[model samples]
Target: MTLPQALQYLGTAVFAVSAVLAAGRKGLDLLGVLVIALITATGGGTVRDLLLDRTPFWFTDTGYVVTILLSGCATVVLLRWRHPSERVLQIADALGLALFSISGARIAEAAGLPGLIVVVLATITGTFGGVLRDVMCNDIPLLLRPGTIYGTAVIAGATLYVLLQSVGVPRDTAAYAGMVVIAGLRLAAIARNISLPALTIRDTDAD
Candidate 1:
């Protein structure tokens, strides 16, 4: 496979692992874990493909689905035997987000999409799967959470990709750089508990 495609597969595996961890934490059974894992692994790419009017990658190539399923099963078995620390899972999630965000933007750009659309589509492709997984697990989606910074990180990466591309950087190198920046930001945010300012409203007329 090409470098970009390889990165996409790696990202898919990471996200599948995250989903397995989430499902386990929620006390889901094996089947439930597999279901969430599949959704979390492919949901974002599926949406991206639909928006781009292209065949879903998983449908076109069985490798993606096989990787997710095998990884999901392995995760369940491993977690059932012994659970890993929360920090490890968070690290994996951040890496997955970064990789997926860059890959998504690169794919959109390759398809000749505008910069603005590429950025938006990249964010969607990076976060939509997690949102679906969270919803199915009955937790508030991380993208909408006040302190997550998930979507923000994705947007930042996508923006960087566009900027680098506009400057005539090679696509593969630019994508790698964007992913590194995104992953760094996410890890820093987690370590520092960094978050965006929240909008607060007060009722002046309240008695």
Candidate 2:
């Protein structure tokens, strides 16, 4: 399989694992778990495809569905025996974000899109699935949450990918570099409790 295809499968599996963990926290049943997993794994790609006027990746390939089902079921079975920590869920999410972000940027670049649009689509493809998962879980989407470094990490990764290519870096190497930058920044933020400063607004009516 091509590297992009492999990254898509791996990213889907990682997102499925995170979905299982998130759904487990909410006491979802097996069916609900599967549903959440499906959404978390494919939601971003679906949106990306719709915007690009292309068929959704899962629609074109059965492998995507099979990977999600197998990964979700296995995670469910394993975690049924032992519950996972929230940190583990976050780590899986970070990995998925990295993989999908880089792959998405590459896809846009291959389509001859400009750098800015590539980054925008990459961020959407990386974070939108998690957004859908959070919405279904009745939590504020991570990307929309104040002080979260999630979208920033994705944008940085995608931008780095574009810059590397501009400097004539090899495609595969640039892709891996982008993934490392994304996952590293995210995981570091988690480990160090790093966060963006929250936005504040003051009322002017009184003045």
Candidate 3:
């Protein structure tokens, strides 16, 4: 399989694991776990496709569905039997976010989308699943979190990808570089607890 195709599967599986964890934390049943897994794995891509006027990859390809199902079931079974490392979750989150973001921007780039739109799509593809997952678990989404590098990391990588390509880098090379930047930045953020400053408005006194 092509690198991008492989990345797609990897990202889906990793994100499915994250979803299973969230669902398990909420005391969801097996069926509920599967539902969350499937949606969190593909929800971002589904939105990207709809906005791009293309059929969602999971709809056109049975492999995507099968991958998500197997990932969800295996994650549920394994975690039920034994505890997993938080590092696994962190690594997966970083990789999945990077791959999905890069792939989303690449798709838009192929369609001749503007740079700003490409960046937006990349951020959405990277973070929308986390948004859905958080909302499903009745928690605020990570994207909405105060002082987080999550979305910013994705945006930085995507912007770099566009800039590199504009400067004559090969598309595949640029994409790989972008993915690496994203994963590196995300992992670093997790490891270092790096965060952007939160935005706030000065409080006003009421009469």
Which one wins on lDDT?
3
- Looking at candidate 3, what is the lDDT of residue 18? 89
Write one digit per residue (lDDT tens) for candidate 1, span 123-150. Answer: 9889999999998888899998988678
Candidate 1: give the clashing pairs: none
- Of 2 and 3, the candidate ahead on lDDT is 3
Supply the global lDDT for candidate 2. 0.89
- Stretches off by above 4 angstroms in model 3 are 205-207
Error of 2 at 82 (Å): 0.7
Q: What are the lDDT figures for the candidates, one per model?
A: 0.87, 0.89, 0.89
Better of 1 and 2 by TM-score: 1
Best by the TM-score measure? 3
Root mean square deviation (Cα) for candidate 3: 1.7
Instruction: Output the better candidate (2/3) by TM-score.
Output: 3
Displacement of the residue 9 alpha carbon in candidate 2, Å: 1.9
Ranking by TM-score: 3, 1, 2
lDDT (Cα, tens digit) per residue for candidate 3, span 67-143:
98998989878986886899878998899999999999989988899999999999988888888888888999989
Candidate 2: misplaced stretches above 4 Å? Answer: 1-4, 85-88, 203-207
Give the Å shift of residue 202 in candidate 2. 2.0
Off by over 4 Å in 1: 1-3, 203-207
Estimate candidate 3's alpha-carbon lDDT, on a 0 to 1 scale: 0.89
- Candidate 3 lDDT trough over 10 residues, lowest sum: 75-84
